[model samples]
Target chain A: MRFLHTADWHLGRLFHARSLLEDQAHVLDQFVALVRDVRPDAVLIAGDVYDRAVPPPEAVALLDDVLARIVVDAGVPVVMIAGNHDSAHRLGFGARLMAAQGLHVAGRTGPQASCVTLHDAHGEVRIYALPYAEPAAVRDALGLDLPSHEAALQAQLAAIRATHPPGVRAVAVAHAFVVGGAVSESERPLSVGGSGAVAAEVFAGFDFVALGHLHRPQTIGERVHYSGSLLKYSLSEAEHMKSVSLVEIDGAGQVTIEPIALQPLRNLRVLQGELATLLAQGMDDARRDDYIYAVLSDTGALLDPMARLRQVYPNALAMERTVLARSGQASAAGRQLRELDTGTLFANFFREVADADLDGDQRRTLDDLLADMAAAERESA
Target chain B: MRFLHTADWHLGRLFHARSLLEDQAHVLDQFVALVRDVRPDAVLIAGDVYDRAVPPPEAVALLDDVLARIVVDAGVPVVMIAGNHDSAHRLGFGARLMAAQGLHVAGRTGPQASCVTLHDAHGEVRIYALPYAEPAAVRDALGLDLPSHEAALQAQLAAIRATHPPGVRAVAVAHAFVVGGAVSESERPLSVGGSGAVAAEVFAGFDFVALGHLHRPQTIGERVHYSGSLLKYSLSEAEHMKSVSLVEIDGAGQVTIEPIALQPLRNLRVLQGELATLLAQGMDDARRDDYIYAVLSDTGALLDPMARLRQVYPNALAMERTVLARSGQASAAGRQLRELDTGTLFANFFREVADADLDGDQRRTLDDLLADMAAAERESA
Candidate 1:
């Protein structure tokens, strides 16, 4: 049986504070076209169907349209789970009815008494769909107060394993931060302070495991894979390529996996150079249309850098003055903030933020505030 | 053909700035029960399914659950339209697929493109469901620049009339104000200035007209009716008898209209008395649970009247100091703000808001402001 594996669509993601709905929609259209060609028996979306627990109305509408096109138009069965970013209740609302239409959404769900079965020439393949559940939720469900993310996921997998069928291939769909997987900056830490990672060996008996919660696609074992997110959700992901994984299982229960690349409408690019050179001749016209994250090397004065860059690169979403950033960092390496004089601190803060020094009148206001503080301190003492 | 007609559910409505979700859920549960008992051939909701165009997730979930219960479980076909409050495209997503499951949602629909047909003992009953269209939308759809709300409604009616079927009973579901319908303060004006009332004569061709956008249950003709909102939406609708319209159309082209009352879980109420009296024994314990809008008659100052009233009426949502209100209104009738001194003006404003005059310190501050103003004006001159 052939099935597609993907996760972390993050449909309503706001990249650098701008809505990525159009970009997402464009890529999803391509995905639909691909699905038509591939004609897989089923598509497994591991999790993170929405970027937030309560997505915007347009996001909901977009998801609705895409689901209809996939399940109704393409006539392919889909099984999805909820990620940490999704409201399980919202995602799980029409699960039972959608299952009839070949779209099964499993979320806010417990360890199923039995795994869902799909058939091919191999006879049957058992699939266990586990949504991202908090450690508290897992504890409540199993009557065990697990201490960490790994414990919770292991417990969930163990429960499913207890019901695991013998002598047939099994696949587990999960959203977790497993140990030894590469990390991206945009991923929210599932647990506070400590690591939220589970060991890769937890899925020992399963033939294949589909994963989410990391936006970088990589494999930890022959059978375990992270499909990653659809688009560049963060600038840290600017250099990483994105793809969906395909899993083909044989009649003898053997599995072969492949990662299929997606052609994004606009690639995410991080460009670095002096401001004038970057805009005038150094940058390629072909890459100019990409979503640009620019770093300027100029140490001297620059005026309205973001506004000026926008004139040439309309999609330049973020900007950084490397000279100012490094200088500010150097200046702050020695002293505590409260120990510094208010005037110097204020000037440093203004320069760090606005990349400019205070004018004469603004300096006078700061001086007046310092004088008032001196007077109040003297009186209190 | 028998059907239940209701409108202006305004399901996520906030009454006196408090969420009425529970109240709405209670009434809708009763409504589902009614549909089951009545076994109506279909249910017609004219418009305003949600209080806002983008309802909160819980409201969307509530609507989803209710629709599933009615259409999937109870097996009744539902035809609903978009009102002025809803974003048509968002509400109309997946409408075609839903229609296959006996739920017909009509919105962002062109003028008179087609009609939904429901079967009965007769050949069929053609239901023309027209969503609320703005003058601009109507003008664009009909390719004519209309002048007023009446013109827009007339144009839409004309388009629907152009497709009117003969010899079968026809019902038109609309969301608009007709001429001579009783005005309620809480009903949002469909257009600016004058009235957005289209004449009742617009429905001349249709056998029956089910209308919404008027919070009052009233009739303009023998076959035309306003089911009103399922719950009292505004204080102005405190005395309105809310109900769902029951329409039974005979195979012989005859029609019978009945208005069935809906019992709200907690009724909206306005209560008047002195603050202490309201808290102690003025209001009955049975009525205390109602969402109360309190009007305090005490001429004396009262501390946290809303807080005190809430001790008895946990749902006390609003308060008005009648004595201070009328006195302040009477005091300001013939006065000009620039003609009065700062002290007197500040005193009057304070009394109007807090039902008390300024204390010595506050009065001194007002006198100092007046002195500073006089000095500034003199220096300018």
Candidate 2:
């Protein structure tokens, strides 16, 4: 049976504090065009349909439009799941109703693994939907003490395997930060101390595994693959070629994965050079209609970097001034401090400015301010 | 034809700083039950289907479910418009697509007074859709200069009258705060003073004018009526008997207005008594399941009035402590002070608290703080 496997669209993503809705829509338009051309039997979106748990209204509308085009208008069945970025309850709200329209949306992490079995002329294939499961939730749902992400995922997959009926070609979908997989720099840190990594052996029973979370289109082994985000959601993802995978599974359950190219709204280029030299060179390749981000490596101050960049790249979404390879005298502690808590660094900076001792009230206020700043920075970055 | 005309649903309304999605769903379920029993020819919603211009995902899902039930499954035609509260552009996104499914969503003010002509065994009837129009927009759209709200509306009706082709009975649907209609206090002030008031003469040519915006079911004259909101969004509307209006138009365009009884999810009650007395009474009415707003007359300064009220009315949406009514003093000046700019009031309050003279620098700082506070309050509120 011919089916397209794609996931982690992350519809409402913000790259460097600028909305990527237009870029996402551009890529999604390509996907829809592909559906028209390829005419796959079914489309499977593994997980992370949204970038944030609580997406804005525009994001919801975009998603609604895309889904309507694919499943409702195009006469295709779509199977989707909620990823770590989604609120399971929120995503699962109208699953029952949507199922009636031939769109299977599974977001609930119940003890018994939910599966959508579709039958075509070839044979019957069982599609196991395993949404991102928290370790605590997995323990509670499965009645097992799964103290680690790997153990919890393994247990959940094991349950799905145990409940499966015999002689059915099975495929599984999941969202996790798996071990020994290519991690994109733009991907958010899923869990602290790398506890987010789940071993790939967890899905040993499934013939094919479609995964999300890491925004890089790559295969872990012959069976598992990540169909990265539709658009570049961060500068760190600029180098990655975003695409969806088309998998064809025979009646005997043999699978073949085909990479489909995605069209970006614009190529995201990060050029770091002296402000004057960069402007002199000009951005000949930058699409006039595309969003851009520019970085200037000017040791000396420029009057207005934004104004200067806009002359060359009028659609520049952001501009930053950073001096590259500056002479620095730093201890190991200073280097480590850069990697450590930003909150502590901010608190120290504030203490110096205020010239006050860290009293309980001041400390609390500083902590709150630093946290808010960090959150804002993360959102903007 | 037994039809219910209701409007200003504001489906995702947040009341008393709490999400009313669950409450809205409950009330909508009741509305569906009414539809099932009444089995109206059509369901007419005047405008303001969503509370905010941009509704949350849950709200979108809830509205989707309700619309599907009413239009697709129930086989009822729904005629709706975009109110002043709505973003016309966003709401009109899929209007053309949904129109095929008998869900007529009118979101634009221009193409003034377009009719969705419905046919039945009796005869054909023209259902004119006149979405809410700001005076400025109406002027620009209809090629007028500085037209009043009433005049602009009349222009729309005139256009409809000129091009309607005659022979069919017509019913007009609108969204505006009409002058002299009893507006429920729960309805957010559409405009300050006279800006929102539309003259009754605008609907002079139509057989019936089904209006929205005012959250009270009341008739302006023989043919003009406001169908009110489905649920109370504020404690100010505690006494409103919310209902839909059923209008029957004959072959000759003769109209008859009928009030349809609405099954309210719960009665909104406001109780006034001392904290001790309310607690002692322990009133056990099914209406307790409804939302409550309490006014505690505790002059003795009881601590935590909200905490105390929750003991008696657990669902109390708000609590205001009422001291003894003071005799009339400083009538004009006091009223002026009450109307003082919020910025000035904050400045005064801060000055008193800090015990500092208002220097130029201090005043500037205070102004910035007040502006920030006002913005925050507007957002939160």
Best by the lDDT measure? 1
lDDT of 1 at A292: 87
Worst 10 residues of 1 chain A by lDDT: A372-381
Candidate 1's residue-wise lDDT over A97-186, tens digit each? Answer: 456577778867564522568888768888888888767667877889887778887888788777676887888888999899987766
lDDT string, candidate 2, B79-180, tens digits: 888887766645654454566577777876775655687866668777888887666667878887644567778778888888876676677889987889
| Poorest stretch of ten by lDDT in candidate 2 chain A | A324-333
Q: For residues B1-381, could you state the per-residue lDDT of candidate 1 as single tens digits?
A: 898999999877887667888988999999999999999988999898888776666676788789889988999888889988776766775565566677788876574544788787678888888888766677877898887778887888788776666787788898999998997756766654335689999888777888889989888877778989989887778899999988888888677888899888888887888888777873567767788888788998787777878888887778777786687863234324433444676789899999988888877777667655543432221
**What is the C-alpha lDDT profile of model 2 across A218-277, one tens digit per residue?**
888788888777777666677888889988888777889988988787767777677787
* C-alpha TM-score for every candidate: 0.78, 0.74
* lDDT, each prediction: 0.79, 0.73
True contacts kept of each: 0.18, 0.04
- What is candidate 1's DockQ? 0.15
Going through the candidates in order, their DockQ values are: 0.15, 0.13
